[model samples]
Target: ISVWTTLAALLGGMLAADVVLGVTPAYFFAALPRAVAISNLWLALGKSMVFGLSIALIGCHYGLRVKPNTESLGQGTTASVVTAITVVLLVDAVFAVVFKNVGL
Candidate 1:
Protein backbone atom coordinates (compact mmCIF):
# COMPACT_ATOMS: atom_id res chain seq x y z
CA ILE A 1 0.00 0.00 0.00
CA SER A 2 2.80 2.39 0.83
CA VAL A 3 4.61 1.62 -2.40
CA TRP A 4 1.53 2.26 -4.46
CA THR A 5 0.63 5.32 -2.46
CA THR A 6 4.12 6.72 -2.85
CA LEU A 7 4.17 6.05 -6.55
CA ALA A 8 0.82 7.73 -7.06
CA ALA A 9 1.86 10.72 -4.99
CA LEU A 10 5.15 11.09 -6.81
CA LEU A 11 3.54 10.80 -10.18
CA GLY A 12 0.81 13.25 -9.30
CA GLY A 13 3.25 15.71 -7.85
CA MET A 14 5.52 15.50 -10.85
CA LEU A 15 2.65 16.00 -13.23
CA ALA A 16 1.40 18.95 -11.24
CA ALA A 17 4.86 20.48 -11.15
CA ASP A 18 5.17 20.10 -14.85
CA VAL A 19 1.85 21.75 -15.50
CA VAL A 20 2.39 24.56 -13.03
CA LEU A 21 6.05 25.28 -13.67
CA GLY A 22 6.19 24.45 -17.38
CA VAL A 23 8.78 21.78 -16.71
CA THR A 24 8.89 19.05 -19.26
CA PRO A 25 8.56 15.44 -18.14
CA ALA A 26 11.98 14.57 -19.52
CA TYR A 27 13.66 17.41 -17.69
CA PHE A 28 11.78 16.70 -14.47
CA PHE A 29 12.76 13.04 -14.50
CA ALA A 30 16.34 13.90 -15.36
CA ALA A 31 16.67 16.41 -12.55
CA LEU A 32 14.81 14.38 -9.91
CA PRO A 33 17.61 11.94 -9.11
CA ARG A 34 20.26 14.61 -9.10
CA ALA A 35 18.13 16.95 -7.00
CA VAL A 36 17.53 14.45 -4.19
CA ALA A 37 20.05 12.46 -2.22
CA ILE A 38 19.65 8.68 -2.21
CA SER A 39 19.70 8.57 1.57
CA ASN A 40 16.94 11.12 1.79
CA LEU A 41 14.82 9.10 -0.61
CA TRP A 42 15.35 5.95 1.39
CA LEU A 43 14.54 7.79 4.58
CA ALA A 44 11.24 8.99 3.12
CA LEU A 45 10.32 5.48 2.03
CA GLY A 46 11.17 4.09 5.44
CA LYS A 47 9.08 6.75 7.11
CA SER A 48 6.13 6.01 4.87
CA MET A 49 6.32 2.30 5.64
CA VAL A 50 6.60 2.92 9.34
CA PHE A 51 3.70 5.36 9.27
CA GLY A 52 1.50 2.88 7.43
CA LEU A 53 2.30 0.04 9.79
CA SER A 54 1.87 2.18 12.86
CA ILE A 55 -1.49 3.47 11.66
CA ALA A 56 -2.74 -0.03 10.96
CA LEU A 57 -1.63 -1.34 14.33
CA ILE A 58 -3.02 1.62 16.19
CA GLY A 59 -6.30 1.41 14.32
CA CYS A 60 -6.63 -2.22 15.21
CA HIS A 61 -5.79 -1.54 18.80
CA TYR A 62 -8.45 1.14 19.14
CA GLY A 63 -10.94 -0.85 17.11
CA LEU A 64 -10.62 -3.84 19.41
CA ARG A 65 -11.18 -1.67 22.44
CA VAL A 66 -14.60 -0.59 21.23
CA LYS A 67 -17.54 -1.67 23.37
CA PRO A 68 -20.65 -3.33 22.00
CA ASN A 69 -22.38 -0.02 21.33
CA THR A 70 -22.76 2.29 18.34
CA GLU A 71 -21.48 5.28 20.28
CA SER A 72 -18.42 3.42 21.50
CA LEU A 73 -17.67 2.16 17.98
CA GLY A 74 -17.83 5.65 16.50
CA GLN A 75 -15.72 7.04 19.28
CA GLY A 76 -13.13 4.31 18.87
CA THR A 77 -12.83 4.83 15.13
CA THR A 78 -12.59 8.61 15.51
CA ALA A 79 -9.94 8.26 18.15
CA SER A 80 -8.03 5.80 16.03
CA VAL A 81 -7.91 8.15 13.06
CA VAL A 82 -6.98 11.15 15.14
CA THR A 83 -4.30 9.33 17.05
CA ALA A 84 -2.85 7.84 13.90
CA ILE A 85 -2.59 11.25 12.29
CA THR A 86 -1.00 12.74 15.38
CA VAL A 87 1.46 9.89 15.64
CA VAL A 88 2.48 10.28 12.01
CA LEU A 89 2.99 14.00 12.40
CA LEU A 90 5.08 13.51 15.54
CA VAL A 91 7.17 10.86 13.87
CA ASP A 92 7.72 13.10 10.90
CA ALA A 93 8.85 15.90 13.18
CA VAL A 94 11.25 13.53 14.92
CA PHE A 95 12.66 12.44 11.58
CA ALA A 96 13.11 16.06 10.58
CA VAL A 97 15.02 16.73 13.78
CA VAL A 98 17.14 13.59 13.55
CA PHE A 99 18.00 14.25 9.92
CA LYS A 100 18.68 17.92 10.42
CA ASN A 101 22.37 17.37 9.90
CA VAL A 102 21.89 14.84 7.13
CA GLY A 103 20.60 17.46 4.64
CA LEU A 104 17.21 15.78 4.48
Candidate 2:
Protein backbone atom coordinates (compact mmCIF):
# COMPACT_ATOMS: atom_id res chain seq x y z
CA ILE A 1 0.00 0.00 0.00
CA SER A 2 2.81 2.38 0.80
CA VAL A 3 4.50 1.53 -2.46
CA TRP A 4 1.33 2.08 -4.41
CA THR A 5 0.64 5.35 -2.65
CA THR A 6 4.14 6.56 -3.36
CA LEU A 7 3.90 5.57 -7.00
CA ALA A 8 0.55 7.28 -7.34
CA ALA A 9 1.92 10.48 -5.81
CA LEU A 10 4.93 10.39 -8.09
CA LEU A 11 2.74 9.83 -11.11
CA GLY A 12 0.47 12.67 -10.08
CA GLY A 13 3.46 14.97 -9.88
CA MET A 14 4.62 13.87 -13.31
CA LEU A 15 1.22 14.44 -14.76
CA ALA A 16 1.07 17.87 -13.22
CA ALA A 17 4.39 18.77 -14.74
CA ASP A 18 3.31 17.47 -18.10
CA VAL A 19 0.17 19.54 -17.91
CA VAL A 20 2.15 22.65 -17.13
CA LEU A 21 4.54 22.04 -19.96
CA GLY A 22 1.73 21.22 -22.33
CA VAL A 23 -0.28 24.32 -21.56
CA THR A 24 2.34 26.83 -22.53
CA PRO A 25 0.68 28.77 -25.32
CA ALA A 26 3.68 28.23 -27.55
CA TYR A 27 3.41 24.46 -27.37
CA PHE A 28 -0.34 24.41 -26.88
CA PHE A 29 -0.90 26.15 -30.18
CA ALA A 30 2.00 24.47 -31.93
CA ALA A 31 0.93 20.93 -31.09
CA LEU A 32 -2.33 19.44 -29.91
CA PRO A 33 -5.22 21.40 -28.44
CA ARG A 34 -5.75 22.19 -24.77
CA ALA A 35 -8.56 19.68 -24.49
CA VAL A 36 -6.25 16.93 -25.66
CA ALA A 37 -3.67 17.97 -23.08
CA ILE A 38 -6.28 17.82 -20.34
CA SER A 39 -7.50 14.46 -21.58
CA ASN A 40 -3.98 13.09 -21.59
CA LEU A 41 -3.45 14.23 -18.04
CA TRP A 42 -6.62 12.48 -16.92
CA LEU A 43 -5.67 9.37 -18.82
CA ALA A 44 -2.23 9.26 -17.21
CA LEU A 45 -3.76 9.66 -13.78
CA GLY A 46 -6.24 6.87 -14.45
CA LYS A 47 -3.52 4.54 -15.67
CA SER A 48 -1.34 5.29 -12.68
CA MET A 49 -4.16 4.62 -10.26
CA VAL A 50 -5.01 1.34 -11.94
CA PHE A 51 -1.42 0.14 -11.94
CA GLY A 52 -0.86 1.17 -8.34
CA LEU A 53 -4.00 -0.55 -7.13
CA SER A 54 -3.14 -3.70 -9.04
CA ILE A 55 0.31 -3.99 -7.47
CA ALA A 56 -1.03 -3.17 -4.02
CA LEU A 57 -3.74 -5.82 -4.26
CA ILE A 58 -1.31 -8.44 -5.50
CA GLY A 59 1.13 -7.63 -2.69
CA CYS A 60 -1.63 -7.80 -0.09
CA HIS A 61 -2.84 -11.16 -1.35
CA TYR A 62 0.63 -12.71 -1.29
CA GLY A 63 1.49 -11.10 2.03
CA LEU A 64 -1.63 -12.46 3.70
CA ARG A 65 -0.65 -16.01 2.73
CA VAL A 66 2.69 -15.86 4.54
CA LYS A 67 3.28 -18.14 7.51
CA PRO A 68 4.40 -16.97 10.94
CA ASN A 69 7.91 -18.47 10.60
CA THR A 70 10.77 -16.07 10.03
CA GLU A 71 11.79 -17.86 6.84
CA SER A 72 8.29 -17.74 5.47
CA LEU A 73 7.90 -14.08 6.35
CA GLY A 74 11.21 -13.22 4.72
CA GLN A 75 10.31 -15.15 1.60
CA GLY A 76 6.91 -13.55 1.41
CA THR A 77 8.43 -10.12 1.74
CA THR A 78 10.90 -10.85 -1.03
CA ALA A 79 8.19 -12.21 -3.27
CA SER A 80 5.99 -9.21 -2.68
CA VAL A 81 8.79 -6.81 -3.46
CA VAL A 82 9.66 -8.63 -6.66
CA THR A 83 6.07 -8.84 -7.72
CA ALA A 84 5.49 -5.14 -7.10
CA ILE A 85 8.60 -4.16 -9.04
CA THR A 86 7.72 -6.45 -11.92
CA VAL A 87 4.21 -5.11 -12.09
CA VAL A 88 5.46 -1.53 -12.06
CA LEU A 89 7.91 -2.20 -14.87
CA LEU A 90 5.37 -4.12 -16.91
CA VAL A 91 2.82 -1.33 -16.55
CA ASP A 92 5.43 1.24 -17.52
CA ALA A 93 6.25 -0.72 -20.66
CA VAL A 94 2.62 -1.01 -21.53
CA PHE A 95 2.19 2.72 -21.07
CA ALA A 96 5.19 3.38 -23.26
CA VAL A 97 3.76 1.23 -26.02
CA VAL A 98 0.35 2.81 -25.74
CA PHE A 99 1.70 6.34 -25.70
CA LYS A 100 4.00 5.71 -28.63
CA ASN A 101 1.24 4.27 -30.73
CA VAL A 102 -1.09 7.05 -29.76
CA GLY A 103 1.53 9.67 -30.72
CA LEU A 104 1.64 11.14 -27.24
Candidate 3:
Protein backbone atom coordinates (compact mmCIF):
# COMPACT_ATOMS: atom_id res chain seq x y z
CA ILE A 1 0.00 0.00 0.00
CA SER A 2 2.77 2.43 0.86
CA VAL A 3 4.67 1.50 -2.25
CA TRP A 4 1.66 2.14 -4.45
CA THR A 5 0.86 5.38 -2.70
CA THR A 6 4.47 6.56 -2.90
CA LEU A 7 4.62 5.73 -6.57
CA ALA A 8 1.37 7.56 -7.15
CA ALA A 9 2.63 10.54 -5.17
CA LEU A 10 5.81 10.64 -7.22
CA LEU A 11 3.97 10.51 -10.52
CA GLY A 12 1.23 12.91 -9.48
CA GLY A 13 3.68 15.31 -7.91
CA MET A 14 5.90 15.19 -10.95
CA LEU A 15 3.02 15.87 -13.32
CA ALA A 16 1.62 18.59 -11.09
CA ALA A 17 4.97 20.31 -10.87
CA ASP A 18 5.45 20.04 -14.58
CA VAL A 19 2.05 21.51 -15.41
CA VAL A 20 1.37 23.88 -12.53
CA LEU A 21 4.84 24.82 -11.28
CA GLY A 22 6.89 24.52 -14.44
CA VAL A 23 9.30 22.12 -12.77
CA THR A 24 10.37 19.12 -14.76
CA PRO A 25 10.72 15.66 -13.19
CA ALA A 26 14.43 15.79 -13.83
CA TYR A 27 14.77 19.00 -11.86
CA PHE A 28 12.54 17.64 -9.12
CA PHE A 29 14.70 14.61 -8.51
CA ALA A 30 17.85 16.56 -9.06
CA ALA A 31 16.99 18.79 -6.13
CA LEU A 32 18.15 16.04 -3.82
CA PRO A 33 21.83 15.58 -3.09
CA ARG A 34 23.33 13.34 -5.71
CA ALA A 35 22.60 9.62 -4.95
CA VAL A 36 20.39 10.43 -1.97
CA ALA A 37 17.11 9.58 -3.70
CA ILE A 38 17.16 5.86 -3.06
CA SER A 39 17.93 6.37 0.61
CA ASN A 40 15.01 8.77 0.88
CA LEU A 41 12.75 6.19 -0.70
CA TRP A 42 13.93 3.57 1.77
CA LEU A 43 13.39 5.95 4.66
CA ALA A 44 9.80 6.68 3.57
CA LEU A 45 9.03 3.00 3.14
CA GLY A 46 10.49 2.14 6.51
CA LYS A 47 8.57 4.88 8.28
CA SER A 48 5.31 3.78 6.61
CA MET A 49 5.83 0.18 7.63
CA VAL A 50 6.43 1.21 11.21
CA PHE A 51 3.35 3.44 11.18
CA GLY A 52 1.21 0.60 9.83
CA LEU A 53 2.49 -1.76 12.51
CA SER A 54 1.87 0.72 15.31
CA ILE A 55 -1.66 1.49 14.10
CA ALA A 56 -2.50 -2.17 13.74
CA LEU A 57 -1.21 -2.93 17.19
CA ILE A 58 -3.13 -0.09 18.77
CA GLY A 59 -6.31 -1.09 16.95
CA CYS A 60 -6.04 -4.68 18.02
CA HIS A 61 -5.34 -3.69 21.60
CA TYR A 62 -8.29 -1.34 21.88
CA GLY A 63 -10.53 -3.72 19.97
CA LEU A 64 -9.77 -6.54 22.37
CA ARG A 65 -10.61 -4.33 25.37
CA VAL A 66 -14.09 -3.52 24.18
CA LYS A 67 -17.07 -5.03 25.91
CA PRO A 68 -20.15 -6.31 24.10
CA ASN A 69 -21.99 -3.02 24.53
CA THR A 70 -22.28 -0.38 21.80
CA GLU A 71 -20.91 2.26 24.17
CA SER A 72 -17.84 0.20 24.81
CA LEU A 73 -17.32 -0.29 21.10
CA GLY A 74 -17.62 3.42 20.43
CA GLN A 75 -15.23 4.29 23.24
CA GLY A 76 -12.77 1.68 22.09
CA THR A 77 -12.85 2.98 18.54
CA THR A 78 -12.24 6.53 19.68
CA ALA A 79 -9.38 5.48 21.91
CA SER A 80 -7.89 3.43 19.12
CA VAL A 81 -7.95 6.34 16.71
CA VAL A 82 -6.43 8.73 19.21
CA THR A 83 -3.73 6.34 20.29
CA ALA A 84 -2.91 5.42 16.72
CA ILE A 85 -2.50 9.03 15.74
CA THR A 86 -0.37 9.78 18.76
CA VAL A 87 1.83 6.78 18.16
CA VAL A 88 2.24 7.67 14.51
CA LEU A 89 3.37 11.16 15.38
CA LEU A 90 5.77 9.83 17.96
CA VAL A 91 7.15 7.35 15.45
CA ASP A 92 7.56 10.06 12.85
CA ALA A 93 9.40 12.27 15.30
CA VAL A 94 11.66 9.46 16.28
CA PHE A 95 12.37 8.69 12.65
CA ALA A 96 13.20 12.30 11.97
CA VAL A 97 15.55 12.53 14.91
CA VAL A 98 17.23 9.25 14.14
CA PHE A 99 17.66 10.12 10.50
CA LYS A 100 18.87 13.65 11.08
CA ASN A 101 22.28 12.77 9.73
CA VAL A 102 21.05 10.20 7.23
CA GLY A 103 21.44 10.85 3.50
CA LEU A 104 22.99 14.20 4.21
The count of residue-pair clashes in candidate 2 stands at: 0
Query: Which candidate would rank higher by lDDT, 1 or 3?
Result: 3
Task: Please provide, for model 1 over 1-104, each residue's C-alpha lDDT reduced to its tens digit, 9 standing for 90 to 100.
Answer: 66687678778878998899988888878888787777876787789888889999999999889999999999999999999999999999998888877634
C-alpha TM-scores of all predictions: 0.76, 0.59, 0.84
Ordered by TM-score, highest first, the candidates read 3, 1, 2
Per-residue accuracy of model 2 over 83-103 as CA lDDT, tens digit each: 888988998888877776452
Q: Which should have the higher TM-score, number 2 or number 3?
A: 3
- Lowest-scoring 10 consecutive residues by lDDT in candidate 3? 29-38
Comparing 1 and 2 by lDDT, which wins? Answer: 1
Each prediction's whole-model lDDT (CA): 0.86, 0.72, 0.88
- On a 0 to 1 TM-score scale, where does candidate 3 land against the true structure? 0.84
For residue 6, give model 2's deviation from the true position in Å.
Answer: 12
Off by over 4 Å in 1: 8-22
